[model samples]
Target: MREGSPGWARLALLALLGSILVPLVAAGLRSVLWALVGIAGLALAAVGVWWTLAHTGVVRAFGVALTVTAPVAVLALYATFGMLWPALLSLALWVLALTAARTASTRGRTASGQAVAEAPHAPWVLMNPRSGGGKVGRFHLVEKARAAGCRVVLLDGSQDVTELARRAVAEGADLLAVAGGDGTQALVAEVAAHHDLPFVVIPVGTRNHFALDLGLDRDDPTAALQALSDAVELRVDLGYAADRVFVNNASFGAYASVVADPAYRDAKAQTVLKALPGLLTDEDAPRLRLRAARTSAEGLQALLVSNNPYGRAVDAGHPGRRERLDSGQLGVVCVRVDNAAQAARLVRGPRSPGLIRLSAEEVVVEADTATLPVGIDGEHAALPTPVVCRSAPAALRVRVPRRRPGTRRRPGTSRASGAAADWPRVTRLALGPLLRQRHQARAGASGSDSGSGSGSGSGSER
Candidate 1:
């Protein structure tokens, strides 16, 4: 119950209620038990306001810091649900009622729970209207902001998000929100930095990749809006490629070329038709020597820099992490492969080999024979010569809904794993020992630098 785990106590209560044939004495005993539960629930609620980390530590902070609003939230959810269905109580209400009545007197401690001050105010809303199936505009977010006593300005179309954000600050707008894609999310973040404003992110596009990383709601506009109410600001890291700020990832080699092509987008059939075989099996496709950041630089095939280091055995997309927004370092991943057989080996999934992951503050990328096509987040920009990417100072503040119990976040796949086997390895190169001096470790190859790091929180650095 403390973990918000679904248990059988509620089922037992339901059985008793469903059968009115139960004797009056038995019903009275059931009522007492329910009352005890109510007490425990309320006690936990009170403790939450003081508990900094609810879902971790000795019990593992199971929820986000925003859990301080638990009392109001739980009641709101139940009242809303009960209006729709009377049985909603028999299911979700009884459990909560018991907690509220039984645990109303508990005391707790704090984990940096400070009330916000009015002076020096700067607020931001980083909205990805193009996320989560592009349903953001329907959330009526504008009204919600006004209710909170904040100025509201919506960014849409091809407007320069960063510049608009700057102007918003000039116009005395302390808070900003962009209704758009993750690419747009990054742009808004860059502007927020100019004003030193705390950004609140609204996920309204497909995937909501960055939203997921920040433990925010990809759905539920109300909860996302509510999260911005008592915003307890935290600074995460930002990645930079030249002048631009990327919140999630950066990629080089074929990824840049693929995403840059207008014809390759959204149309899965066409993307596969053109990208596959053309990259892996085609002899005419371009290649490059790879070098992973903060590791022994290698003249392998491809290169990638992530927002954070990935875990071994974790899929490129599912790097299980504790802090996706820690602002200090970056993650670099790379793979080396030469032919199709090795490509097939890497394609087997889960066991992709020769995968190297590195953590560093910065890295340098260059090409020998040709200019490298780089994808900075999802937006394709001109190829910079000898691109130098580094972790930017502090982090762009964005608001996201807290994580819910048992939500299903799908794991990300490497380029090869996501697509055809034709182009498995990045290119031909030599693997060298890292700074400590280690030899080559041999195995298969895959989309080592396929920008899985972007999913973490840092946008593409390319």
Candidate 2:
């Protein structure tokens, strides 16, 4: 069974209980010994890596030393842990289970490739050479685009991307593609939507969250080039906060403040730590008024509005993945507390008491200041107070590779939700009839045996 299924969950619970109880009843010392051995193996591996990297001895001699001993040490540790077969078996089984889950989840939903290899018009690709540390140049994206018959435009930071996209569309570019960060993707996607051109995402960004959600292979930008040949067009929603468009999410309050910090990009942890003390402790922190659904809150320290709702469970396979992109609603999360303790608790569990999370077609955030600092798709901006966020459902048409690497559903799509909701019924329908037949057969057999015994007894009396 796939992970998180009822069968798998039951087995996991049993294993966990057995692990705790069986040790107490028997071989307690052996379990402790195995734990120690595993810890020792990890420590030894760390030491090996450090020694091989940090030692300043004779170069060739050090290489020889590491080359000779590292494998031996690893093998020794493996042998100490019962010949390593069990570990290998466990790893193989884990891989098999993961593959099964992915396959089961994507059975009939994933797009398939057809051998057409045609484009309506030459595609214009907007590439930011500076995005993801010059990923375009590093990956030879221009050469690849040329090979794919795409007209490539290098964004030199001089021209407005929106205008550039407009010009491309005017000049007979039927399809729009971007090889840049989410910020650039949003700008180009907006233009694509306005022109009714199919959009393609080349994930050359630091996060590429939008691309990831689209089920594109974020690891390899070249993989997306295949969409030009064999593609599947999917209609997805876009999120707008004020005049700005965001592909992933927009953030207000704490996250916005942190991203707006001058040193945040280079020193994220330090910047957050420095900003947290004042943000949490200041009683005069600007309170944000939020109205969504039937919930109204004032003085919320932070607000996050996503294009689609993220899964509620922290341990879900894909925690922040949108089940479907055309959900037609904005996922809003409100943080009511301004204290560090509350923040810590939230990190410990997403279901912490002070968090109010919900999905809505629109969310309005009012602030005391004339302008509120907001982080839109990881880029910081200042928007006028009373910021209105809304979902533009099916606003953009995205061209993705046929047989996309990881095809999954978005949050609010009724079909996906209905499938999940109807799983219990489906399972019962498949098994319930067989169970009833078995019970009837067993009961009939018992009745037949009783009748046969009564006849035998009557015959004996005669």
RMSD in Å for candidate 2, one decimal? 10.2
Q: In candidate 2, how many Å is residue 119 off?
A: 1.5
What is the TM-score (0 to 1) of candidate 1?
Answer: 0.57
Q: On residues 1-462, what C-alpha lDDT tens digit does candidate 2 reach at each position?
A: 112234432333344344445433444456566445544544444343333332334632454465566556655765675535544444454444433333223212212223345665689999999999989988899999989999999999898999999999989999999999999999999999988888999999988878877778777999999889888787888999998999988999887988999999899977875676467446776778998878788888888998877544232344445555776888887776543344334533446766777899989999989999999998899999899999998899888877666654322121222121223333444355668999999999999999999999999999
Q: Rate the local accuracy (lDDT) of all candidates.
A: 0.51, 0.71
> What is candidate 1's CA lDDT for residue 206?
64
For residues 1-462, what per-residue lDDT tens digits would candidate 1 score against the true structure? 021112322332344354332322334445445434434445454344223221224322422233345445555644553321333334454444333222221111111122344422444454445455556557766666567655665545566667767877887767666556667877878777766776766666665556555555556655556545544444566787767677777777666767777876768445644564355335665555443353564444556666654333235564323233453677676655454334334433335564455668887776664456777777887665667778874656544333331123221111111121111111110111131233222211123334454555465543
Off by over 4 Å in 2: 1-118, 312-320, 340-350, 408-462
Error of 1 at 23 (Å): 53
Q: Could you tell me every candidate's TM-score relative to the true structure?
A: 0.57, 0.69
